[model samples]
Target: MTDFQTAARAATVAMRDVFPATPLLRNAHLSDRFDADIWLKREDLSPVRSYKLRGAFNAMRKRPEVPLYVCASAGNHAQGVAFMCRHFGVNGVIFMPVTTPQQKIQKTRMFGGDAVEIRLTGDYFDDTLRAAQTYCAETKGYFLSPFDDEDVIEGQASVAVEIEEQLGRLPDHIIIPVGGGGLSAGAISYFGNGTQYSFVEPLGGACLRAALKAGRPVKLDKVNTFADGAAVGQIGARTFARLRDVGLANALTIPEDRLCTTMLDMLNVEGIVLEPAGALAVDALKDLGQSIRGRTVVCVTSGGNFDFERLPEVKERAQRFSGVKKYFILRLPQRPGALKDFLGLLGPEDDIARFEYLKKSARNFGSVLIGIETTDAANFATFFAKLDTNGFTYQDITDDEVLAQFLI
Candidate 1:
């Protein structure tokens, strides 16, 4: 075995004292759908509902003498470190963005208990991270990076170690979700070239892909935080060093809306609750259909800290991506009979979820904003055709991001 493999195995052995190795269960549903033997390394089932706890525990265990720990994270990593801090009996100061979901902040506080102090600092994560680092440096507290530290990477490698032992052998393909690159780096170090690897990242925060293309880490201009767990704007320097050589072709970016589809599928069909990032690895399978047809594939479901409150938004995005839901602006003639005339165009499966007049005072016509949900994508084609045949003017605003954000 390689040096990384040796270290990873040792880490996995040490982790058992804290929490049992997460399950590597063969997913019959995925296997049947893909026509391949598929296994899911259920990192979501970890004590902190993420593989991040492994890294936190390993890092803290190595620094038993350190009295204080500091970190900045608005998602799973924060919970992981907080959980570890409580377990290790160390004081922790966690800095989070002010805009972070209250659910995540509450979970972190619950995990840390009295051992940790939660600080709501900056408006964005970068600001929160800077505040944490500055505080750590001044107070001489140990700063725990989510993915940059070597010790943390070693801990993450434990996932690969457990996978090998659980499966008895390496699978033909391993699919991993990438954020700051820690998990992908650790897994790559442990497995090396022994298995085919596919790296999946949320399209809005594909720092790994951007770094690989640039030959170094670069900050993204903007990031969509729908998949908050993996919405890293830049790849960590240390992680990028290890992952620099990963082929571009092996990296896949999943659209935020399309990822919602996978998240909903796992929840509704398999009774699995996956955060958007957790669903990344499994969602990539749709893009790799033919390539993995006859192979033994392992997908690491990274985290499942999904807030039930976001279910409506998740379902909305899924429907939009699946082409069954849409928002539009229609120019309706301002007459009492015009409303009754338009109602005749509705199909059996068509339902109006939202109807508001944008310009109610217009003398001749009114601008109406409408949200329509239908049984299938084709239903919209016929619906639009009927509208055109009847000379109705409308604009599909479902894909107009800025307008949708402001109006929807």
Candidate 2:
């Protein structure tokens, strides 16, 4: 075996003393839908609800004498490290962005118990990471990188180890979510040229794809933080080195909104709860439809620490992406029966989710903001036809990101 495979095997054996291997279960629903044998490597079911724990456990075990540990993360990684710190009886200081969800912060604290100190720092993860590193250097504590360290990469390869043993053989295809590239690198190293691989990334934070295009890791101009767990602006240097040769065609970018639809489908149909990042692999299946048919495919559901409080927002995005929901600003004549005329344009399945006059003081015309939800995406075609036939002046603001952020 190659050196990485040997190290990864050792990590896998060591991990058994910490937590049992996460399940590799055949997903019958997905198999039936795609006409393929589909399996889910349930990293989401890990003790920390993420494959992150494997890296944390392995990294810490390799540094048994370190009195203190420090790291920064928005959620999953922090929880993983905190859980490891508590288990290893080592003091840990975790820094998180101020805007991190309260649910994650609380869970991190619970996992660390008395062994970890939580520090709410920086508005962004970069700033928080800098602060954590600086503190670690000043205090002479071991800094645990979320995905950059060699030990962490080897630890993450344990996922591939479990998959191979559980499946009895390598899968025909494996889809993995990429954020900082740690998981993808580890898995790629473990499997080498033995299996087909695809890397799925959130469109707003596709650092791996950007790196492949540029031939080096580069920071994204901006990243949508909806998939907090996987929305990394830059791929880690060490990870990028390992993933540099990944085929460009095999890298898939999933839109953040379309990802919401997958998240909802897994929840509603299969009764699986997945965070935005966790659903990345499953969502990529749509892009691999013909290639995967009759083939055995494995999708790594990376994490399930979804806060239920975001359910409404998830549903809203799913509806919008599916084309059944839209927001528009209408220019209506301020006259008697004008409101009645617009109401008459509505179809039976079209429901008004929001309606408000932009400027109620207008005398001749009033700007009205309206949100419509329908039963079918095709229904919007008919609805728009009626608007055009009536000569109504309106602008669909659903896709107007700037305006939607301010007005919606």
Candidate 3:
């Protein structure tokens, strides 16, 4: 075996001592929907609810001399490190953004117990990472990178090892979600050209695609954090090395809002809980269409650390993606019955999700911020026809980020 494969095999064996390999189950729901045989490498079932624990365990296990370890993450990586810290009985310091969800913070603490110290640092990951590194240097702790380190990449390759062993052969295609690229890198290294790969990322976090385009890692000016687990602003340098040669044509960018649809579908239809990032690969199958029909494909369901509190937001996003919900800013006449007249035009399936009166914009008209949700996407067309016939001047502000942020 090649050195990388050998290391991955070792990591796989070591991981068995901690937790059983995550399931590689054929998903009949997805299979019937896509007219293709679909399998899922359920990394979400890992001890930390992510593939992160593999890298954490591998890195820590290789260096028994490093009694102190440190890492910065507001999500799964932090939990993975903390779990491993407790497992190895080592001292760990984890830095997280102050704005991290309380559920995640509490879970990390519960996993680490006394083995880890939690530090709430920066408002952003970049700041938190810097703080953690400086502290590690000063305290002589081994700073564990979430994805940038070679050891971590080697560790993550174990996922492919498990897939191979469980399935007894390579899949025709593997759809992997890319953030900082460690998982993609490791999987590609193990599977190589023997299997086709479809790398999916949130449209806002397509760093691997960007890096491939630039022939090196490049930081994005802005990142969308809706899928915070995969919301990396830049691909890691080491990860880029393994992934740089991947063709841009092989990458798929999933819109942030569209991912919500897949998350909801998985939850409602299959009873599978998936975070936004976890649903990326499944969402991409729609984009792939008939090209993969009849092929044996594996979609890595990356993580399931979704907080139930975000369900409303996820539903809203899914509705928006499906075009069943929209927000509009209407200029209403000063006449007393105008509001009543507008309400009467709505179809039975249409429901007003939000209604707010902003300040008056003109002498005879007032601006009304309204959100409408309907059972069918076609309801918008009928609603707009009624608006036009009634001579109501309105602007669809559903996609207006600035206005939607303030009102919706």
Best by lDDT: 2
Identify the runs in model 3 with alpha carbons over 4 angstroms from their true place.
360-363
lDDT, residue 82, candidate 3: 98
Q: Which 10 residues in a row give candidate 1 its minimum summed lDDT?
A: 1-10
lDDT of 2: 0.95
Native RMSD of candidate 3 (Å): 1.2
Per-residue lDDT of model 3, residues 55-147, tens digit only = 999999999999999999999899999999999999999999999999999999999999999999989889999999999999999999999
The CA lDDT of each predicted structure is: 0.94, 0.95, 0.92
Instruction: Please give, for residues 1-408, the per-residue lDDT of candidate 2 as tens digits.
Output: 899999999999998998999999999999999999999999999998999999999999989999999999989999999999999999999999998889999999999999999999999888999999999999999999889899999999999999999999999999999999889999999999999999999999999999999999999999999998899999999999999998799999999999999999999998999999999999999999899999999999999999999999999999999999999999999889999999999999999999998999999999999999999999999999999999899999999999999988
Residue-wise lDDT of candidate 1 within 89-121, one digit each (tens)?
Answer: 999999999998899999999999999999999
RMSD of each: 0.8, 0.8, 1.2
TM-scores of all models? 0.99, 0.99, 0.98
Candidate 1 backbone overlaps, count: 0
**lDDT computed for candidate 1:** 0.94
